[model samples]
Target: MSATPATPGTPDLPALPVLQADCSNCFALCCVALPFAKSSDFAVNKAAGTPCKNLQQDFRCGIHTRLRDKGFQGCTVFDCFGAGQQVSQVTFGGQDWRGHPGTAGAMYEVFPVMRQLHELLFYVSEALALPAAAPVHADLRRALAETTEWTAADADALTTLDVGALRGRINTLLLRASELARAKAPARKKNHRGADLMGARLAGADLRGAGFRGAYLIAADLSGADLRLADLIGADLRDTDLRGADLRDAIFLTQAQLNAARGDAKTKIPPTLARPAHWSA
Candidate 1:
């Protein structure tokens, strides 16, 4: 669903089926393996490895349909990138922690690791989809293959893997891929990489080809801003206003970022991403 243009060298990007989370195939790992303190996002404090009060016996959230209405807004924005099912079904052979209490500790420990790996795969897959990044496609393909292999490793192998090193290594190629794609924009671009723009008013600004990598745009007003070709890797978009913004062909923009931001029906997002259900129709 990516909108990247196709060139001679860049083949059509295949769908990344494994990158989409399938909760039915998962054991509700996120509700138990991760901890969240009571805040604007969560209703109560839950310790790591403890099953959430809202979690049901069948491994589904009791308040899933009303997560936001019940003060668990954080859950709506979090995406495991299919790591839960990978850990539960593939890594542990579909073993539920409740049935195998002895594996709970290890499962909890490996979930985060697997989540990080899956996240990287998501980014790498997006990078591969970009036609402008054809120069680095070979490297991106290798990185994707390697990351996919790691995702299939046993729990023991996964827990011991050096994720930081792998992330650092893959990030280099992603950065280059971002640069190549951004260079295609003819206009002069802004470099706001890692800037703390929280709550700033940036409505209607032209931000095409802008580099927002690792930037903090929390609660920033970006309504009607032009974000085509912007590199948004690792950017914090919590509560960012994106109404009427043009994000077609935006690089490195993830569903999690879109879910955290506020938008209206006019917001033009990448074809690959879905409009957040909370957004106004």
Candidate 2:
């Protein structure tokens, strides 16, 4: 979710999405820093810090439009959480590591670090916008401010950041915010925190207020599910059927997760999330 670093100081500034990945300015950092095993989702095995074969000289995916057809579907669903452009344009000053070998190592090392920070930014921003989470909004705002500022840090500073510790600190506030938001919807039927609901049939379920943190719902039938205010932090929704599902107020749902799933025009999603391009028309 990186978008050219917002151009530093533009006038008449518009609100930026919590983490928008603007690949127009990215240097294909994800193609290098991330590792992927050959699988049904990815076409080949690639080690971390190694460039992908399909990465073009200009840092764009050579087969961008045919990713799924070429067996690189995982690339289609993976989001760097804006780390790519932040690392390429901001942290490294719009320099391509290919031409400058000195910066290549640092760029790869710092990418995943920025990814973690931006992910926290995403959740913090979402929590701040929830009216039901107003009680913890100020705390979330502070966390968002702190995390947003951290994104501008240099590669060395980012590498040394205690990301796990920061995530722990922020998770406390996010947990409280989730509690306040879910309390508004009293029709919850389950608390499936870290549940393995893979392939389960949950279509049209009364899932309001369900705690789905870390749930593995791969290929689950969740069509038309009532997911309002459900805290879905870290839920794996790959290939899950979300057609007609109402997730307008579902906390922590991300574009990457949505991109990995199946849906249709009938799905009710948050304004913050765009329908994945691959979803059926």
Candidate 3:
């Protein structure tokens, strides 16, 4: 968890902004909608559409602070990308499934879909913010508008929506955005797309603008690595060491990804993200 040395008086850069989860505005849909197996990641076997054992009547996690301590590390790292609020507030009109038993089934089904759509929003928002993606700005804006509109639909409408098809189209556009961004650092080593880098010893590697899409970097040592503008879409970072790494402008990194990784005070992160509370100094 050591940081690379920086010159005195150097200032941190602005953090990249993206659609993020606001758990406070949510009704804890994740606790009810998703299932988990009893493994290292979770302490119990849970079924889909059923509430977890640790969920309180107030719709808050009873063990939120001690999730990892209690072997529910998966819960600690999961992010809904703002879907929980959209589902609880917008889609269902503040009507909780628990209050209306009939709505529980539909609510659970739509929650995952909304999570996926919100995830797309995260990417679109990121692409729109990238100056290098100006060539596709028009298309990105259009997609954002359309997706925003779709997210406003009610439960039945959401259930029938072809979210997978929509995701495909967005992925295509995002790939272009990534290409444009990575073009900034052409000399950097970046062709590790979808590689199994689990527990890889990549500490201090110069990974500027690298493509880490879908890479399994579980417990990988990334301390002091320069990860600026790196494409981190869908990268698994559970227990990864990121202390002192520069993740500024890294593409497609979610709060979930950051929460899952281990870092220290010296790790540079996007301005939009807060350092995980669990991180060691």
Whichever of 1 and 2 has more lDDT, that candidate is: 1
- What ranges in model 1 sit over 4 Å off? 1-17
Q: Give lDDT tens digits, candidate 3, residues 177-230.
A: 999888987556568889999999999999988999999999999999989989
lDDT of 3: 0.85
Candidate 1 accuracy as lDDT:
0.90
Q: Give stretches of model 3 more than 4 Å off.
A: 1-18
Model 2 C-alpha lDDT per residue in residues 1-281, reported as the tens digit of each score? 22122221234222333378889888898998889999999979999989999998988889999999999989888887777888888899988889998999999999898998889988877776667777776666667767877888888999899999999999999988888778888795378989999999999998998889999999999999999888889999999999999998888999898998899999989897899888887
Rank by lDDT (best first):
1, 3, 2
Every model: Cα RMSD to truth: 3.3, 4.7, 7.2
With a 3 Å backbone cut-off (N, CA, C), the pairs that clash in candidate 2 are: 1-20, 1-21, 1-82, 2-20, 2-21, 2-22, 2-82
127-150 in candidate 1: lDDT tens per residue? 877888888887777787788778
Q: Judging by TM-score against the true structure, name the best candidate.
A: 1
TM-scores for candidates 1 onward, in order: 0.94, 0.92, 0.91
Clashes of 3: 1
Count of backbone collisions in candidate 1: 0
Sort the predicted structures by TM-score, highest score first. Answer: 1, 2, 3
